[model samples]
Target: MIKSLLIANRGEIACRIIRTARAMGVRTVAVYADADAKALHVRMADDAVHIGQSPAAESYLVGERIIAAAKQTGAEAIHPGYGFLSENAAFAQAVIDAGLVWVGPKPASINAMGLKDAAKALMAEAGVPVTPGYMGEDQSDERLKAEADAIGYPVLIKAVAGGGGKGMRKVDAEGDFLSSLESCRREARASFGNDVVLIEKFILSPRHIEVQVFGDSQGNVVHLFERDCSLQRRHQKVIEEAPAPGMNEATREAICAAAVKAAQAVNYEGAGTIEFIADASEGLRADRTWFMEMNTRLQVEHPVTEEITGVDLVEWQLRVASGEPIPLRQEELSIDGHAMEVRLYAEDPASGFLPSTGRLDRLAFGDATRIETGVEEGGQVSPFYDPMIAKVVCHGEDREAAIDALIDSLADTEVWPVRTNAGFLVRALDAEDFRKADLDTSFIERHGDDLIPSGEADDAIWSVAAQIAAGDDQDELVGFRLNAPARHAVWLSHRGEGRLIDLAEAEAIAFEDDGDLLSAVDTTATAYADGDRVVVFSDGVGYAFDTAVRGSGQGSAADGAIFAPMPGKVIAVDVAEGDSVAEGQRLLVLEAMKMEHAMTAPFAGTVKSLTVAAGQQVEVESLLVEIEPDEG
Candidate 1:
């Protein structure tokens, strides 16, 4: 085995690689950008090196810097963990040329599946079932439109080199084709530096199921079964599971077999995933499933597969890269049980799933089957990277038990101040449709409102907040009116809304310390006092309220000013000063965490001042534009 390995990535994957490498007695080197100097992965590694500045293009994505860091640290191999340079064919070749073992497939395999159009053509030639689409060399708009017209309405316009749902558009009719095509191409160029695209017939009810495949340097390949990644939002997977629910023996065998075939066709090596899109309008069947794409590296959801198959994929990658044969064959590998994984992101579901950044004041989780995370309490979730805080995984004898265990695990998860999808995930797992496995890519969208209800505090919550404000002086009777029979009030703010609760009239009260429940209500709600804010963990969600008197807290921004919802770079300013605009008109676009978010006008108005320009970085709540409300 390789003695020392360099992880060419950051965040959870880097930390994950470090765990397995150290366990195998391999020294590990972690490379970090300036922003990740204090990251958890850096502390876990045997040695650390600074690559470049905070921006990925200046650091993680720079192949030369990574190579230099590996050589300086005397790393015998480099593991491109999931992202950054993981799928870059040239980077793999460069590493091999430097006489360092690349813990991945040969460069040829990466190139074969790098672009969607080319990869689809290759898969077709290899006899892997592929979706019907246009993969021609025609770049003319008319030809592309004709192809889409032939493919029929509701076609998908996807970037040839895109991943993570970027540079993809679904056009339902000819009227929207041109505009959608332009938008898709623009995003494609921005994301992948390639404007080429491919059009596919969009499946009405698509389910994303990917098979985990591994190959050794000796030209042996095997699969670790399949995972259902159908639960998605914005085309990005939110949750994933192994031994796909509702999968029959026939469909499972066919999908797994196709995955193995695809891997062998390219003479694949190391760990890779073959993703398929199944038209579930008629349920999962071999013929309904078609090759969507292949991930040429370890995936973010690899843990679920590990849980079900009792395999350490990272260890397999190391051994294979060291010239070992495949550890298990198709007949030897079999699923043990059901497993589920949910990505706990630092994002607010109520705020359109916008990325949130802050110091993690409190972060905790249950005794999950496995938990992979890169941040701890007091850790900074910087705006410079993906907002995923942790990935929680659980396993059980079957799918229902796994779901039940996952829900309890989420309930045990506690996060404060920094918003999360914990509450949402629990609801999603507990949903009647979800429990029955009625899943698809549109699951989140179909039940978004129910999953992400308005963060309104109930009376019981207010009662708890009021007790915390009174402090630990239980000797003094809270809200005891000595003079007259009048109700005493306490002011609290929650979810940007303030409330004045009459403490003396509260129905029930509760206060606890160190898991002790002291209340009339028969419920356990853990709460603690943090400065002027009272933090509480109740019913699978975390809440914090500022103890303020009425009229003292900060109010919303001025009526006409458009505040930056989060810190990001201004990518586009659509209107000039004095331009008339209607309500909800897109005025500016901000790029943060590699995602574009549009800022729209709150009401019909004339632009009074446009203070920001393209390429300027703005902090959260910084005023970028101000409009004069139209005097109708």
Candidate 2:
């Protein structure tokens, strides 16, 4: 076995690898950027090394730096946890060339499946079922348009080297093809350094199903069943489950077999996943499923597969990298029960699910579920990396029971100040369609209204905030004077509404009071105050209210100034100082947490000032531009 290993990643996945390594009596080395010096993974590892600056391109993506760190720290192997340089074929070769064991598949395998266009042709030639589309090498825009026309309308323009929905676009008609292709290429270049693309027929009701396969140096490969990742938002997976809810024996066997065949065809080794896009319009038919792509490393949602199969996939990766054969034979592995995993992110569901960054303040989840996290209460959710807070996994005897457990777990979770998708996950799991196994890529969109919580905080919630502000004292009538009831009014702003409530000194705030005329508030609320800002937890959602004080907590920016919504680096400034802009025209693009957010003009105007330049790092609410309203 490899005596020591270095994890070339960050967050939960890095910590996960360290845990299994420790259990196996293998020393682990952790690498961190400047922003992650105090991160949980850094503290958990046996030894640590500083790589470079915070940005991944400057740090984690530097293959030579990682390899040198591993060698200097005496690590015998390097584990590139799922992102960054994990799927980079060159990085794998670098590790091997440096005499360090690469804790992933061979570089040849990664190169084989590196690009979607090339991989499709290879899979087809190897007898794997592939979707009908254009994977030609023509790089001309006119050729792409012709291919889309040939494939018919409603085709997908996808980055040839893309994952996690970064460089993918869906076009419903011919008129939208060029712009969509441009957007796809731009994102692809930004993400993968590749501008190549592929067009495919879009499956209207597609169910994303993937099989977890493992291979060893001994040429043994086996499948650990399948996972259903149908629930998605913004083309990214939101929830995943093992032993797909409505999967029958025949479909399961066929999909798993095809996955094994794909892996064997590549002569793959280590942990990998074969993702299939299943057309579920008529339910899961083996023939309707098409090969989408292969993930050359461990998946973010590997815990669900681990839960049902009673296996530790990370340990398998380590063992295989250390030259062990497949842990279990094909007959030995079978689905045991149902397991579901939901990705909990530090992002606001109300504000277009923008990444929420700040102090954790409060992060808690139930003990009944498995929680994989790398952050603590005082940890910061930086804009330099992914905004994921944790992964909550629950298992039960069956699908319904597993979902019930998952819902309960989500309801029990509490994250304050930094917003989260907890409430949304609960509502999604409780949706009738979800409970009935009616799932597809459009699940979230179909039930979006129910999932997005109302922004307005109710009277009861306001009362709870008031009580917390009043020190939670039930002995004295709040704000009451001896002569008369003291007129103490608390001003709060929530969801664009300013609420003013008067507190009577003679009446105590009761926790059990119903929302009647006198007690129109539910008092069983959790609240904490940060100076004048109070955050209350109610109905599985966190509501933050700013105390309406003069010169504080007002609307963002001046009348003509465009302020940064969150702390990020200005990647592109689209307007000049004297440029005229129309309403809703994008003025700049801010790159935060590896995602791009466009800042647009509120109304037609002329640029009065451009405060920040491209590549400048700004804080939340920092002014980026100032506009003067056009004189009519």
Candidate 3:
């Protein structure tokens, strides 16, 4: 019996584990870094221990330090919730060596499935179908490229240690293989700290179907069915659901069987997910599927699995580690309802999906099916970790009802100050391709522009803001005093557009503009005017802005176009004094909140002047890189 458990990760997953463990009468310990001191996960746990500094390499990645914290806190088991050091074989072994129950798969199992090539080989040896690829001992780039050539174009050059699509790239043709290979290697090295890569035959228009497999120390392994995660961007799963839609009874059993076989081959114990990419173009076929990789810990999208199967995977992990048999057998398990989980990230979708960082001034997501989060209002979204804020999951009797609940939950969520992907998810759900069940991994890429869910406010909101600026209160009924001024100019800035509206105040301003009836619902209100703008407070955080257009051109120089790539402090300037440079040349590295972003040139040109010096904190669109027009 595990009495206490320490979660070795942060964010929503940590909060999720704590919720389940506490319900099972188990105490939870949360470990946080410098950046996550005031995080909600830390607040939700029974006990929290500060490990080290903010950077992951110095804090969360320190496996030995985490083990020490667990031992010191007397936590009987350590759960490496998903990311960070969850997949590290050494970390699991260290937890076992520290005389604490490791609430995860055996370290040998982690080592077995950690590498894509090794996992594929092991799956093949265990009679599980494997994808055709170069999973040999050869690390030669030439051999890999040759293998890709033989396999055919549209091959996938993926990192052996890749998950979350960080170290993966799709090569459409032979001409672009090497370049994509280089990019994949760079991203893989940066994300996973491992550069080993493998090439696999790319199944075009495929559906990412994965199975949820759970095992115990008693040699019992069973799957909780499948999840279809084909909706992705850059190979990172955005939406996932259990009992994968469109899968037939026979195909579902076969796929789950394969997943169980893959897990059993490693003698795996505890919660693990075996991901298999199935060719949904031909529907679900046993021969058309291939072994992808096995995640050796609880999944980020585990809520959907719990929703349909009615199982708490984290509790099962605790119970299994406590030397209990698997919760249920194949005969007892059944999918009850349709469920969906959407990753709500603190990022600006209109800005090329750039990570948005700021204090969450106001955060409120009303009671939905389930809102799992690890941050609250006043919590900062640091660049040190993943930018995901919460996972909003909703379940219903069927897929359509589930989708409707999910859409409604998003509309009801109000997160101000920091931008989010909520609007984009809403638009995605409303898309024709999605509504009609026409989805794939390429869904986001193909329909991304059409679904341009932006941060820019619409014209109607600006009109309302302008009305509020000119003493228009939506919540008050004001009688028109004939002695006062009959007309006033109302100005507002919205979506970067200057809006100027002349309003005549009255008991009811009876007018029509742009098919919108102008009616003043309230007038008795206090308005605080700041410069040319004012906010009419009403309802909650209600701000109606009216402002005059400050028409000014900054500069016609190349400075207008070239800007800093990310929010990083400038480390070193690579160009100065009108130096000539070619395309893709590095200009300066901006080190923001901490990560380094090298601002580069898009074309060959001579540097006119460097606007910023070394060690400057720059925003994303700030002027940084400057270059003259290239001469013939």
Candidate 4:
């Protein structure tokens, strides 16, 4: 095995690799940007090195800096954990040329699958079933529109070099094809530096199923079953499970076989995933499943596959990189039990899932089966990286048991000040369609109204907050003989709305603090209190309330002022000063955390002030534009 390894990544994935390397007695080196100086991954590694500034472009994406850091620390191998340089073939070759083992697939395999158009062509030549699409090298708009017409309506326009849901657009009719193509091309050029695209027939009911495959330097390959990632939002996966809920033995065998064939065609090494798009308008039929693309490194959801296969995939990556054969053959591997994983992100579902960033004043996940996180209680959720805080994973004897356990685990989640999608995930898991396994890529979009929380604190939650506010005083007043009124009022404010609750009328509430989380004794409600602020958690949603006495005053609206929702760079400014616009006209676009958000006019008006322009970085709540409403 390799003696010392350097992880060229950050967050939970880096920490995960450190765990396995340490258990195997291999020393680990971690590289961090300025923002991650006190990060959990840096603390966990045997040695740490500062690369550059906070932004990824200046730090993590600089391959030469990473290679130099590895040499400075005398690392024998470099493991690019998933995101930063994991799929960069040039970086992989550079590491190997520098005499350090690259714990990933060969650079040749990465180059072969780097672009979707060429990869699909290769898959077809290798006798693998690929989706019907246009992958030709004609970069003319006329050719793309003509191909879309030939493929039929509802075709998917995807960037040739895209992943993580960027640079992809779905057009439902001919009239929208040109505009959607333009938008897709612009985003593609901005994100991947490649605006070329391909067209494919969109499946009406698509289910994303991917098989985990491993290979060795000795030309041996094996698969570790499949995972169902049908639950998605904005083309990004929110939840994933192993051994797909409704997959039969025949479909399983066929999909797994094709995955092995695809891996062998590339002479793959280490861990890789073969993703397939299944048309589930019927069920999971082998003929309906087609190759989507290949992820040339470890995946974010690899933990669920590990749970069901009893395998440590990171350990396998290390051993294979050291010239060992794959640990198991295809026939020797089998699924053990059901497992599920949910990504806990620092985003607010009520605000259209905008990323939330701040110091994690109080963060706790109680008694979860397994948790993979990079931030602690006092760490910060910076705007410079992915907003995911942790990944919650659980295992059970069967699918039903797994779902039940996962629900319980999510209910115990407690976060405050920085909002999260925990409540949204809980509702998604407990939905009737999800529980019945009636899943698809449109699950969240179709059921969004029912899944998102109302952002209101109910009477039960307010009562719990009141109990905490009246702490110890209520206990002392028990059995008082003198002039104690039947009810005492407690003044509180929630979301800027004030209310007075009668302490005597409140239902008997109890609380217990277990050093990690504050829970209502004998109830499912959880709460946290710091000074005058209290946050009550129900169904994994935190509702913050102020305990100080205050008059009932409504909050003022922004009227015509548009503020930056989060810290981001202004990508486009469509309007100018004195420009007349309609109520919903596009004003500008902001890019943050690898996503674009368009700001629109709140009402019909003339632009009075335009303080921002393209390529300017703005902080949270900074004034960007102001509109003066049209005179009556």
Candidate 5:
């Protein structure tokens, strides 16, 4: 095995790799940007190197800096953990040329599977069933539109080099094909620097099932079964599980065999995943499943596979890179039990899932089976990086037990100030449809009303907040009797709504001594107080109320002033000063955390001032535009 390893990534994945490396008695080196100087991954590594500024373009994506850091730290090998140069063929070649072991597939293998259009052709030749799509080299507008029309009414236009749900669009009708294609191409060019695209017939009921395949330098390949990743929102995976709920033995065998064959065709080495899209309108079947793409590196949901199979994928990657044959035969690996994983992100579900960035005043996940995280209680969620804070995983003897364990773990999650999707996750896991395994890519979209929290504090939440605001002083009450109680009113506000809660002094003290008021009312609710402010957490959503005075919260969009939700660069400006605009008209686009958000006019009004321009970077709450509302 290699003596020392250099991790060319940051956040939870880096920390995860470091833990496994240390157990093998190998020294580890970590690379960090300006925003991650004090990150948990940096502190956990044996040695650290400062790469560059906060922006990923200035640091993590710079291959030369990572290579230099490996050399400086005397690391014999480099592990590109998941993101940032993980699948870059040229970077893989460069590492090999520099006489360092690259803990991934060879350059040729990565190149073979990098582009979707080319990979589908390769998989088809390998006898793997591929989706029916148009992968022709023609890039004309008329050609793509013609192909979409030929395929069917609903078609998918995917960027040949796209991943992570970016650079993709679903065209529902012929009239919207060209506009959707333009938007998809623009996003693809901005993200992948390639405007080439492929067309596919969109499946009405699709389920994302991917098989984990491993290959050795000795030309042996074996699959570790399949994972169900159909639970998604905005094309990004929210929940994943192993041993799909409705999969039968024959269907599983066929898909797993096809995955192994695809890997063999590339002469693949190390760890990789063959992702297939299944038409689940009638249930999983061999004939209905088809190859979508191949991720030529470790995946974000690999832990679910690891839980079901008693194998350490990272260790296998290390042993394979060090010239070892396949450790286990196809028959040796068997699914032990069912496992599930949920991504706990630092985003607000109430406000359209906008990324939340600030100090983690309070963060706790009590007694979870396994938690992969990179931020501590006081750490910051910078606007420069991905907003995912942690991954909560659980395992059980069966699927229902695993789901129940996960729900219990999520209910115990406590995060203050920074919003999270904990409540939303619980609701998704406990829904009747989810319990019945009625899953698809559109699960979140179809049940959004039942999933997303209302963000309004109920009576139980207000009662808890009032008790916390009362403090521990009993002498402050006018009529403090041992038997009877003195009534007192506490004023509070949430999201600009004010409420006056009346509770007896004795009742408040009695509940406080019992220490189960919130739990009795709502099992998922908890309360915390900071100075004069109290925040009640229910179903993983934190509803903060000001205890000092009513109506002290921030103003809303009714004033016609639009502020930047977070620090980001203005990528597009669609309106000029004094321009008349209608409500909901797109005014500008802000790019942050590798995603684009459009700012729109809140009301029908005239542009009073345009304070920002394209290419300018602004901080949070910085006014970007002000409009003068029209008279009624």
Candidate 6:
């Protein structure tokens, strides 16, 4: 087996690869950004190297820096843990030329699937079923639209270089095709540095099923079953499970065999995933599947595959990289049970899934199956990286039990500082359609609200908030007197409304006025006192309300003004001198953390004032737009 390895990635994935390297008696090296200096992966690695600045372009994407780190650390092999340089063909070649084993597929394999347009062409020639559409390089808008029209309306306008849903759009009508195409191209250029795009037939209701395949130097390849990644929002996968629901034995075998053939076609080695979009609208079968793309390294949802097979895939990677024969033959491998994974992100689902950042005051999730995270209690959820805090994976004897276990585990998690999808996940598990496996890529969009919990914090818990707001008793800690019932007015905010609750009773208290039900619209609020510290849960997050009651006052109209949703540079301004605008009009675009977010007007008004310009960095909640009443 390989004696040592260098993981050219950061966060949970780097840590994950290092774990497998350690288990296999292989030394590990970690390359990090300045922001990841305190990351768990660095702390756990046998040795560490600082690659470059925090930004990916300056650091992780710097193939030279990564290769140098591996050479200096004496690591014989480099493992590109998904994202960053994992699928970069040049990077793979660089590692090999540096006299280090690239613990992944060959550079040829990476190039074969680097561009979606090219990959689709290769798949078609290899007898793999592919979605019918235009993969031509002719970027002429007229030519592209012509292709879309011929392929039929409702085709997908996707950037050939797209990932993370950045540069992809669905056009249901010819009139909307050009604008959506422009948006996709612009986003693709900004996000991936390539404006190349392709049009594909848009499946009305498709389930994303990908087969994980492994190959070694000995010309052997085997498939590790399939994972259903249909549960997604905005083209980003949120939940994934193995052994797709309602998949018959014959269908599963055919898909797995096709995945193996695809891998062998590229002479692929190490861990790779072949994603296929299936027409699950009619139910999963052998005939209704088409090629999507391939991820040529360890995937984010690898845990579920691990749980069912009871095999350490990382160990297999290292062994295969060392030129060992394939670990287990195709017939010898069989999945034991069911496994599911939920990606927990530190983003506000209510506000268009905007990224949230701050100190992680507390993060306590129960130990059900496995929850992989890099943040500690005092750590920070920086906008410098992915807002995802962790991935929770659960395993059980069957799918139903696995899902039930996932629900229980998500409920046990307690995250602070940023809004999360915890409540939404809980609601999703109880949903009828989800229970029946009636899912697709558009499942979240079709039933988004069903997954978002209606403010349902325990009523008993709210009774306490009402009491505290009503000042039933004075705090014995700060304002306490043995004489009169200590009545006090405290300001509090939850969901979208703020209020003052005044109470005088010592033991029991209630809201002073239940005029406007704050809890009804806002998130359910939870309040608890453990000795002197107070813990509160709202908006799918648990927080320490230290001085929450003391600083419970509303800000001026300035506070009501629109603020930057994230820490990004302004890209465009929609308003000029005294322009009238309607509610939800895009006022400006802020580019931060590699994604562009538009700040919109909260209500119909005239542009009273605007601040900042394109290419200026603004912190979260920094005012970006101001509006006034439109008397005209």
Candidate with the greatest TM-score versus the true structure: 4
List pairs with backbone clashes in candidate 5.
Answer: 423-539
Q: Which candidate gets the maximum lDDT versus the true structure?
A: 4
Model 6 C-alpha lDDT per residue in residues 1-632, reported as the tens digit of each score: 78889999988888888887887788999998998888888999999999878888899889999999988989899988888888889889989998999889999998998889998898888888888899986789999999999999899988888888889999999999989999998899898899899999999889999999999998999998999999988888988998799999998988888888888889999999999999877789889888899999899999999998887888888888889977899888898899999998887665566677766656767556998887777787777777788998999999999988988787667675455777787777667888789899888889866677544334344445544343324453233236755446554444323444443332343223343222212333444443333455553444332223543345234423676654457888878748988888888898855677878887788887787777786654456777775555
| TM-score of every model versus the real structure | 0.86, 0.83, 0.81, 0.88, 0.87, 0.81
Q: How many pairs of residues collide in each model?
A: 0, 3, 8, 0, 1, 14
Residues 1-632 of candidate 5: C-alpha lDDT, one tens digit per residue: 88899999999999999999999998999999999999999999999999999999999999999999999999999999998899999999999999999999999999999999999999999999999989999999999999999999799999999999999999999999999999999999999999999999999999999999999999999999999999999999999999889999999999999999999999999999999999999999999999999999999999999999989899998899999987999999999889999999988787688887767888988456689998999998888887889999999899998899998888878886677899899999999999899999999999977898887777777777877776664235232335665545566665545666665622442343434223424334667777767877766777777665332233333367776765578999999999999999999999866779899998899998889999998654457888789889
* RMSD (Å) per prediction: 5.4, 6.1, 7.0, 5.8, 5.6, 6.7
Q: Write the per-residue lDDT of candidate 1 for residues 123-241, one digit (tens) a residue.
A: 99989999999989997899999999999989999999999999999999998999999999999999889999999999999999999999987878899999999999898889999
Single out the weakest 10-residue window by summed lDDT for candidate 6: 512-521
Model 3 lDDT tens row, 1-632? 89999999998889888998989899999998999998889999999999999999999999988998898898999989988888888888888888999889999999998788888888999999988888876868788889999999889988988877679888989989888988998999998798889889998878889899999888999999999888888778888877687888888888889999988898989999998888778677887888888888888888999999898888888889999999788899999989999998877677677776766755766446888888888787788888888899999899888888887777556564556777788778778778667887888888867665544444434444555454444233222336774344444543224444544323233323322223223421222444555533221122324355322322245332466534456789988857988888888776654555677877888887677888776644455756776868
Q: In model 5, which regions exceed 4 Å deviation? A: 477-486, 505-523, 549-632
**lDDT ranking of the models:** 4, 5, 1, 2, 6, 3
The 10 consecutive residues of candidate 3 with the worst lDDT sum are 535-544
Candidate 2 per-residue lDDT over residues 1-632, each given as its tens digit: 99999999999999999999999999999999999999999999999999999998999999989999998999999999988999999989999999999999999999999889998999898888998799888989999999999999899988888888899999999999999999999999998899899999999999999999999999899999999999999888999999887788899899888898899989999999999999999999999999999998999999999999999999999999989998899899888889999999887776778787867767867544589998989888887888899999999999898888888777657676567888888889888999999999999998877898765677777777665554443334233336774456555665434555554521355654322112214343456676767777754577666664322223423567776666678999999999999999999999877779999988899998898889998755456887788888
Where does candidate 1 stray beyond 4 Å? 477-491, 495-512, 515-524, 548-632
Q: How do the residues 1-632 of candidate 4 rate in per-residue lDDT, one tens digit apiece?
A: 89999999999999999999999999999999999999999999999999999999999999999999999999999999989899999999999999999999999999999999999999999988999989999979999999999999899999999988999999999999999999999999999999999999999999999999999999999999999999999988899999899999999999999999999999999999999999999999999999999999999999999999899999999999999999888788889889999999998888788897767877888566689999999998888998899999989999888888888888888876678899899899999999999999999999968999887788888888877666656544332225653445566666545666666766466667655345776558887677877778888888776775322223222478787766678999999999999999999999876789899999999999999999998755457898889988
Model 3 residue 59 distance off true place after TM-score fit, in angstroms: 0.9
